[model samples]
Target: MRHRRSIDLMPREDAADDGATLELLPEWYVLVAKCGKCRHQGRIDRRLVANRRGWGVSLNSIGPALKCVRCGNREGNKLLLGRLPRD
Candidate 1:
């Protein structure tokens, strides 16, 4: 049987009012986090996060759940979406 290549889905609910969940995000768009206390920046893999917290969690909600790997900051860490190279 002939089969077609699978395509990754793009974020469906990215809006001005709210953030998109992991289920809506594509694999290329990685999650970047910045520590509010020490200003340390780090890149987090979406697959690792989804495994722990499930894919239903929102991007905005992931901030509070993160602890800074550098300074051990518990609150105010910001999560930003970073795009990876397609090529």
Candidate 2:
């Protein structure tokens, strides 16, 4: 005999605009991740992508995963932005 597992399905209400006041903010900058091997740097404007998520955010999601424009090597490409400095 096979047992079936029950799953829960629910629709969440959208609270896009809940009488909240909106404020105008200044522009921001994009932290770019530079490739260690070839010295390739990726630039992301601050007004764009928010803070890093989880262990760290991947380069592919933010923008075009850049290749070493100088060396053409894809391996060992380092994240040059949105990460804290190593101690």
Candidate 3:
């Protein structure tokens, strides 16, 4: 059986009420992605997210579809979301 992980998508839900829709999330905030396989983690720019839309990913489901640069895993739904540290 495959392991199932829970991710906190609450921030995005909260952001949505503040006019920060997923499609425009990158414009307003930076996102952190953690790999489910190798556990690799990194920051993903909002523009890159916007670009992902062009590849057919819907805004609502982008989180779980992200690929891990280190492991190339596609089980994005299990990916956690966190705020990037301010510069």
Give me the candidate number with maximum lDDT: 1
Candidate 1 lDDT, 1-87, residue by residue in tens: 222223232222233245568888777777888788998888888888999999998876787788999989988877766667689
- Range of the 10 consecutive residues with the lowest summed lDDT in candidate 3: 1-10
What value does the lDDT take at residue 41 in candidate 1? Answer: 80
The lDDT for every candidate, in the order shown, is: 0.72, 0.37, 0.54
Stretches of candidate 3 exceeding 4 Å from the true structure:
1-20, 23-28, 54-60, 76-87
RMSD of 3: 7.8
Tens-place lDDT per residue, model 2, 20-63, is 11111112212464555766765544333333332233333333
Per candidate, the number of residue pairs that clash is 0, 10, 3
Q: TM-score of each candidate?
A: 0.75, 0.32, 0.53
Residue 60 miss distance in model 2 (angstroms): 7.7
When sorted by lDDT, best at the front, the candidate numbers are 1, 3, 2
- Cα displacement (angstroms), candidate 1, residue 68, comes to 0.3
**Which segments of candidate 1 are over 4 A away from where they belong?**
1-16
> For candidate 2, what's the RMSD?
15.4
Better of 1 and 2 by TM-score: 1
lDDT of 3 by residue, 1-81 (tens): 222223333334333233334554443344667677787877777567667565344444666777888878888434334
